[model samples]
Target: MREFVVQQNQSHSVLITGSTSGIGLAIAHCFARAGHHVMLHGLADNETADALRAAFAGYPGNQGFSSADIASEAGCAQLVADTREAIGNPSILINNAGIQHTAAAHEFPSDKWHQILSINLSASFFLCRELLPAMRAARWGRIINVASVHGLVASENKSAYCAAKHGLVGLTKVLALENADHNITANAICPGWVETPLIQPQIEHIAREQQIDLETARAELVGAKQPMARATSPDAIGELALYLCGDFAGTITGAALPVDGGWSAQ
Candidate 1:
């Protein structure tokens, strides 16, 4: 991971969804270390959530955890309200919660498709709808969506995920244009394969299905789309996210930046 030195400033309230682990957790830590009040939202066991909250308390700003299920409109509303009550309105919102299911489009379960769309695409819209007003009033905000390389390209057996991410990128563009006058920047980060708990299951499944060792499975997975021939570190994505929220990125908006080891370049 690269080292970054964030300029000192007054704390900004940051709300990150699906922050219990993986990419979301990394982004939360990045913001917290930069002296931002961070509220982590995810579904996890009490012990796990408490541990994360305890760790976050050691950081420089107010830190808390929320177990709000953001896959529904009502849940998204409640999460926004609860966050506002806990840490005021968030000036930085990271929509990093997502789930993946693999199956041919013809065989994909209807319920799974709905769930994916709700959490990955619809939840972002709901959160933005509830939060953008306050951000506009504040006249400064950042909306970062953790999209995937699938947002820009396609792969077999990932129909729902691809669709949701594509929709997310489009939504990001619209938000950026609509909020340009308000000093609110909206963008999407399209990461390729990253070594996270979310993708570990898929890696293991590849090992089993391809009858290869775990190491070979990992290599093959990365070889397919990433020219670097390795999965990205979650911290790398975190670093990019931190950069996007910094002062230098004020002019950057409505972009789908790919941190994919050149996967999208292909």
Candidate 2:
């Protein structure tokens, strides 16, 4: 891991989407602490965005924040433009922005389906298209798509999410193959039952409905599919993302690495 840390003279600019909170925020911290100039993007309010940027003030790297929506080509373009204007051309892109909608395939709202695909899958493509040229020109790049366990396996009532994640995994592979000779590597990180703010309400609901403690509720939640019965910390995913950007991970492209507590192994 020490070899992966950015040296003072070799800092890279990173653009992490959906980085105001949760897993995305964790990834942003990882890069910033490692002395990489980081562009943090999320749909956070101005106050919250300011606070997040402030938290990184002590880190060695420069940090910038943006709230540009990335659900369309225009939004993606704006995000890339904002990132370049704020930080620099992003040599490292983490497509961590995502949304979720749960419903049976036939019952799923069409709008929700399109929304999920737009943010989860299409946005990554557009961002990569915009940033890859700079990376190629520099002869260094890392693209990490924050996919999900659903990318490798299916869950009930998550048709849209599964489809989008699976598509992202596929896109990662294609990007990896296409850029193999250009020093750009693309990979997907598929995490299951990550402890994020988005899942806090669900945990609380389970605790209340089952008359159990929060810890037990969390265990019950992950135990449903994960044999380890544990949720991966967002920091763990962030660490992996940081590593993937390092010299040691240069040959690990086109892989869907699972941090799922053995869920995908089943």
Best candidate (score: TM-score): 2
lDDT of each: 0.90, 0.92
Model 2 worst lDDT run, 10 consecutive residues:
1-10
Candidate 2: Cα lDDT at 243: 91
User: How many clashes in candidate 2?
Assistant: 0
Model 1 lDDT tens row, 1-266: 02212321457899999998899999998989988999999998899988997898888888777888998899999888878888888989999999989899999999999999999999999999988998899778899999999999999999999999999999999999999998889999999989986667767999999999988888888888899889989989999998898867888999999988899898
What shift in Å separates residue 106 of candidate 1 from its native position after superposition? 1.2
Candidate 2 per-residue lDDT over residues 7-85, each given as its tens digit? 3138889999998889999999898888899999999888998798789999987888888889999999998989888
**TM-score: model 2 vs. ground truth:** 0.96
The best candidate in terms of lDDT: 2
lDDT of 2: 0.92
Question: What TM-score would every model get versus the actual structure?
Answer: 0.93, 0.96
The positional error of residue 74 in candidate 1, measured at the CA in angstroms, is: 0.8
